[model samples]
Target: MNKSILRVAPMVLSTALCTTAFAYTVQGTVTSKADGKAIADASVSLLQKGKSAKTDQDGKFTIHEDEQDTTSTGIHNQQAVGFVNLSQGVLHYSQSSGPVQVKVFDLMGNLVSSKTLYGTGSVDLRQGINAKGTYFAKVHVGSATQNIKFTTDGNASAYSTSKTKSALLKAGDTDKLQVIADGYDTLNVTLNNLDTTLALSLEKSIPPEPTYKFGYALKNTPTPSKGCGTNTTLKTDKKVENGEHHVVNVNGTNREYFITLPTNYDNTKQYKLLIALHCYGSSAEDFVHHTPDYDHPTPYYGQQVLDKNGDYIFASLQAVGGLWNKGQEDHDFFGKALTTIEDNYCIDTSRVFITGFSYGAMFSYSLAQDYQDRVRAAATYAVADYNIWLPQEKGMDKNLPIAWMNVHGVNDDRCTFDKAKNSALPRMLKKNGKASDGDSQFTDASSEILQENQGSTGHLCYDFKNVDERFPIKFCTWPGGHQWTAHDTGNMSVGWNWESTWVPEEVHKFFEQF
Candidate 1:
């Protein structure tokens, strides 16, 4: 753990003394529903502006916001559809205008039920519609349509989030909503008008995906089985092996994952674990093995050496049902998968790292934000967090902080690099005491500009250093499209394709510091 937490004591004292006692603030403690225990490090913020405060060791926190600072200029993604009356088996939703059309679909994109509501009412899954697994509820009001995805356990079902529109609440008036995640009880939150606590939660709801994999083969069957169970409710049983095609069951649904090991692996040795997430519509194995996407000249992974001794462990994870960090089940899937890896590997806890492409890249931030203690550092390529999610706490742990690096393309059309570097990254920096709107002192530190792809791309890197001199943030933006920059790092490479700006050696170097 970083002992720098001791150095921050003075700063904490200074902040408390500087703030006027009369300033308006909201104080409360956030506790988990599963156990009435204080949820340490939970975010207590004015949900709209993202002005947040971290809970103390006891889960108690005080958040202050200027009374005049309250404003909601954006439409909330998932509107608070009232409470879920589990006993009645009815979920109430609010529609500004009625005579609405509501439709329910399974994860396979097949419509299970449809209805036309004259006004805000309920979706009765209690009727012939209730089976386990994840479901999508589509509500069409007038010309406006809203789709809310939820998970259930067969007996009862509820959406993962609840939110009230910005226009409905008063600036100083406080309101509370209950978030009913499947397999978890409601997470009731007290929200001040300007702060959008629940608003951010609903944005995570997912639509659906075409393919699904869990524990290697068909649904919940053990390995070595071809044709398996018939039910579509997400569920699985898995085993970890080379090219095992593992499946992690979340909320009774089977989510898929894959793993790759270094050549010289030993259980007694401590090794770094790199969790590589694939881009949307991509395979888990392609990034793990060289599928011939390297540049003619020197390339990041495609051309780099592939046969290095097992210095680290590399695991590639396929998104659950083709979704990554988009829903409650996805979050559960990530944590469960990580637990699966740790139980099986002799991982060096201090060096657990992650990197992703596009959608995977965007979700990496969430992994670091939510699992900071385990995720030492993160790097990415392409679009990151199109819908920027604020941190629940400054760092998952103030002392055990995780670093981030971004590698994107300037001329790329898929995900703009400027938006990530100039916009999203700074917001992330703000969480680390980058004063709001303050000019940052990032050095123009681009290194080993690929010797092969010369003049074709603008390769540059920016480093954000911390108090301990452990560079936590590195930004590598090049003149290319959405691609991973894997290059030759003396030792063997982690197999790469042509669309790269850096190498596996460089990537390992960036993370070795943690």
Candidate 2:
């Protein structure tokens, strides 16, 4: 007994010393390198230990080594699981392994809903939990499990669900420290020391490079047109008070259009021109002042409100008999109106943009192809290739690239999402130089590439990266039907009002990027 005790005594002491030696407290502060400002709510993780923490408002986080489970021997490999908030209180999971089990629980740990998805799919929380609040999800895939914390109020958290206050680290063990935040580039650092404080600076994520293949980049400098230093005249019989109303003669028929200039309009300064088109049965006057609901008096699809800086000159073009007639008549009207606008205002020739909804959206898409050389960019909502005749019959310049953005609802039976995905989106991607294989991957609804965009509360926007760098293309899909603004309309149960007005904001942002 004495010999045995003597042998075990050194071993016990050595184990104690080993644990003490590895005991470390790791703390860090994450800040933006651009401004050296604290980045709050950033996720910091010790990758190997499967430990993570969220930075406080002060951008400080602490992790303790003792919190690690010592019995777990293998390194914790990070999974590629991701989650996004879908419309009507649904949680979408993607890039997960097969037989994925998801258990959603409220803050009180009550299991709200539980289901096992085949691979990538969604769980409608409205079926189980009716209230809007913070919830936690536990996802199990094969041998790996991940936790996700999310809010039902449309704010979806990052993919990582690890909320451990501390991480485990053995002495002299090198571990990867990763930091991630919205609008910032992800950071990864190898840590070789412990019991030390760290200051990490994250760089802001750069916007995608502008192609300058079209738009302002095409011109050597801003060109002032004949319309400079002249006030616009109204030729229409209808009385207009707010904007300059004019009528253009296209093949003996009169085409009416309304133009709204910046309040501080300067003739010498060339301004970006935005041409907006109205849907079928909707007049340009109605398009300008029509109130969608009590909350939104949508003027110029809300671009006028967004342009607080008054950098854009707005134009609303009226369709012939409140319908965009097929063939070259509407096209001629568009060209003539554009020329008239350029003749009236100090327009930036290279910075002309177009946006429209429904039938107007179709026209905008047509014009984008027909006038790819003249128009800088085009953004359209609820567009289809079949309903409105395209200028392709006149021979579309497939070589000329134009930055394009399309917002379509997956449930749009009128314009149809199928046509948008199969026909419209493919055409734009092809024109933008996206490879056929890549375009096929994106346009295929059953493909994983398209499936990954399933659940978004407002909309899921996919940028075709394989396309021409100068002419980027984006396709966004929402949950509502054929409507300009995706208003919930009670049937869809899209809980937020912001969804109704998200299109204009998205359009404004997309155009501003150019």
Candidate 3:
């Protein structure tokens, strides 16, 4: 994954300079401000002169600068230049001042190869070298010379002089300096004179915050009332019972739902609430009890894990017409159901979660966006941004970040993985503060990789870097087709077996994080 670097704007600081032309040395120690610890291996660069140095074990680095006359020397004018392509083992040179003598030397100071190229050409450095290691190329043009260090591993170190640690700058010249390191913000400084020892402290970078709550109130702003706490009445059309269907009237339309309370339930104890949405043509009862295969019992998508933990309240909601049309009516029904549950149960307002599969996953994505402040996180499988209608135009804040985890089959046909990869995942990643150009392990071009991992055995999951820490976004891909718990039997067809299902366990682990 590609990491994002925060670059600070250059700020010039004035310093006293001597009138006489003399070389000056700038030395500095880089340290972390968070714990007052030395930061070793940090890169300090003179951007204008293309000179840089790495801090030693003690976090100390010295850059020696010599004042030079640019007009008298061809080196400063760059009349002759060499480009080293380490991967191809070639050194390309361009010289305007006659023939150039190029010599390659190994790290042990043994001469490897020598060649003479005129005007512009390339020399094959691999001709006389067989071992893979660091080598240096010395190019002499007229009275100027250049040394380039390269490795067989496709890395070319910067151009250097005979001293290797020294760089050139005109007297009283202004130059931009930069310092970069991991887990810290990039620092930029401009200086006019050098001959001094300095101590530089790097500030630790702050982790990203959830975008979904950018302009919203605190997550725990909702409080229990009505049937909660001292109030004993469970607000509903019927008494709350495990595996029993209940009704809630939304906009004069009755919607069906079922609740599964922990065996050791307490009216006063606050518990995490998880709402499970059923896929198209699947009812709430079928989702909870219908077994995928005859060999084992129903998994109920994390219900087993929840029952083992015994601190969670699980509820499954049914869609009218056996389909989520992605309309306003379903959105309103969800809102009413959530309000009714929170009003009646002693619920932890900050730990509410939602999950589903297929069309159900589509609605879960919609609800995650519409109820960003109310819902803590969402985990789904075989989800797509298209095909099913989403409440994008419901006037909800789209900038808010929600901790999201999605599992999709690269070979899914009903709700294709292309829609999720191209639209859904990118939107969530962007809202969570990830860079658009950053590298990702999950890509539309990874069909071969996805195919290799296809089966009931294993899958690939990528946790995006540089995203909001509080609301992380994870994308996982499996090898089977559009099924709740995908099972591949080596024919690229969906197979069913309760023991082979991994979705429920993965979802349980994700929700347990909060």
Candidate 4:
């Protein structure tokens, strides 16, 4: 065939020598719903009625529509709900051309949802709808690949299922209910004033853990301890179980927490809760000399492992004077320490997880935007931008489904891993929906497979090295700078160069298959 048309003639003259002005191209092939095969990085998205895209490795993707017309924040009716609230500035994408795995079901076929893939040809998908219907997408693209289906039309799912607490309810017959979510549809609100309807759907498929590791696995049953009083200690053979040091009170203040229990904890089984934030003056027993309770001596990059064996419950919070930017109404003091650790332990509301360092990694980005329904996934180190600590664009909540990990140190100069690892973690992964386009449809041919490097602060490390071990944000750089190198429980804090086989077994293998 004429040598495969001259090797695809430079991808067809680079897709007709660059087409934009609201461009569009979504060639497909992400297979493996159960058998067929051909999925090599399956995360192809293009859900326009609003926006989305991510597919390359060959599955292919290319989206570019934003002819301005901007005005999204819709959901008018219900007397415009409360004082009427809406915000915009969205467009997310990720798939520079590597991993792509997507499996999300609802039209009855079962399977619920799954993600973790990285780029191919075109990638952009940050669709955060609140109300709409008909969604049954599946793309496995590997392991005998052969699964791909798409549909999305109910209109932002009726404005994200409308019912923000009955339009921000506030006393006067508080029962107005209508909050659906099962296979997907039914949002007709009026709660307190009476008028029901809550049959919504889509959110069921999290039972794969025979061995799909990521993070969290402990059950409570330890008995070793040696430090937690004066602070400042480094690794010492490693071993300090005891964990449990509350002071609680929250929102008003009092803070100081550290509750690790899971060697086999029992009161009738009920684990899964994680919160580890420490930076400023750092404490919680100096963030356990760097986690896994690094039997202290003066550690920062000590050493620790063993995560996915099972029982997980860890908490190490402390931030008030160790302020988290101290603005947005004091950032609900870590949601009152997650409501006092989900009202005293036995939590698992959906495997809560959080991690911070460096002003607690900008307070884990304002608690993933005001505790996105009590957190699900978040990992940060050397935070990059919170608009220099909570700039304008306030109160955003797009259905809150999160999965992000941002680490910096491209030779940080007090947070400058190229603006905290390439422009504030890809603009907060397209404002949390997971990539589409936020800073205006990005160009330079959507960042030419990135990977540049110069650092020493002058800046330049566009990086994207290797990702999609289930939505990864891995970026590395050493030659030291800011400090505290991995002592969170991987150890190496002399002059700092301790990446220690990269921490938490790759964050428990990316949330144990998230």
Highest lDDT scorer: 2
Relative to the unseen true structure, what is the Cα RMSD of model 4? 31.4
Of the two candidates 2 and 4, the one with more favorable lDDT, higher being better, is 2
In TM-score terms, candidate 4 sits at 0.21
What tens digits encode model 3's per-residue C-alpha lDDT throughout 131-224?
Answer: 6676666555443334444555333232222222122223224567788988899888775445557789899986554333132223434334
What are the C-alpha RMSDs, in order, of all predicted structures? Answer: 29.4, 25.3, 22.0, 31.4
Candidate 4 C-alpha lDDT tens digits along 1-514: 0000001122222332122111122233433333444334333332222233443454344433322111111222232111111122111223332344544444444555565655433222215423234333333222211122233443433222111111111111122222222222323333221111122222333343332132222221321212212221222232454465666555566656666666765534555666777777766556554443322222221212354454566777665666665665446656665666555555665557787666777777666655645566777667756533453255454323245665454555787666765565555444333223322222122232434334332222232423222233444444344543433222234433334334444555545544
Query: Would you list the C-alpha lDDT of every candidate in the order shown?
Result: 0.49, 0.67, 0.64, 0.42
Off by over 4 Å in 3: 1-228, 235-241, 292-299, 394-397, 434-457, 487-496
Q: Which stretches of candidate 2 lie over 4 Å from their true place?
A: 1-221, 229-241, 292-296, 396-398, 434-452, 487-500
True-structure lDDT of candidate 4: 0.42
Instruction: Please provide TM-scores, in order, for all candidate models, with all chains considered together.
Output: 0.43, 0.53, 0.51, 0.21
Higher-scoring candidate on lDDT, 1 or 2:
2
Model 1: runs farther than 4 Å from truth? 1-242, 294-307, 388-400, 433-458, 465-468, 486-503
Give the Å error, residue 245, model 3: 1.9
Candidate of highest TM-score: 2
lDDT of 2: 0.67
* Candidate that beats the other on lDDT, 1 or 3, i.e. the better one: 3
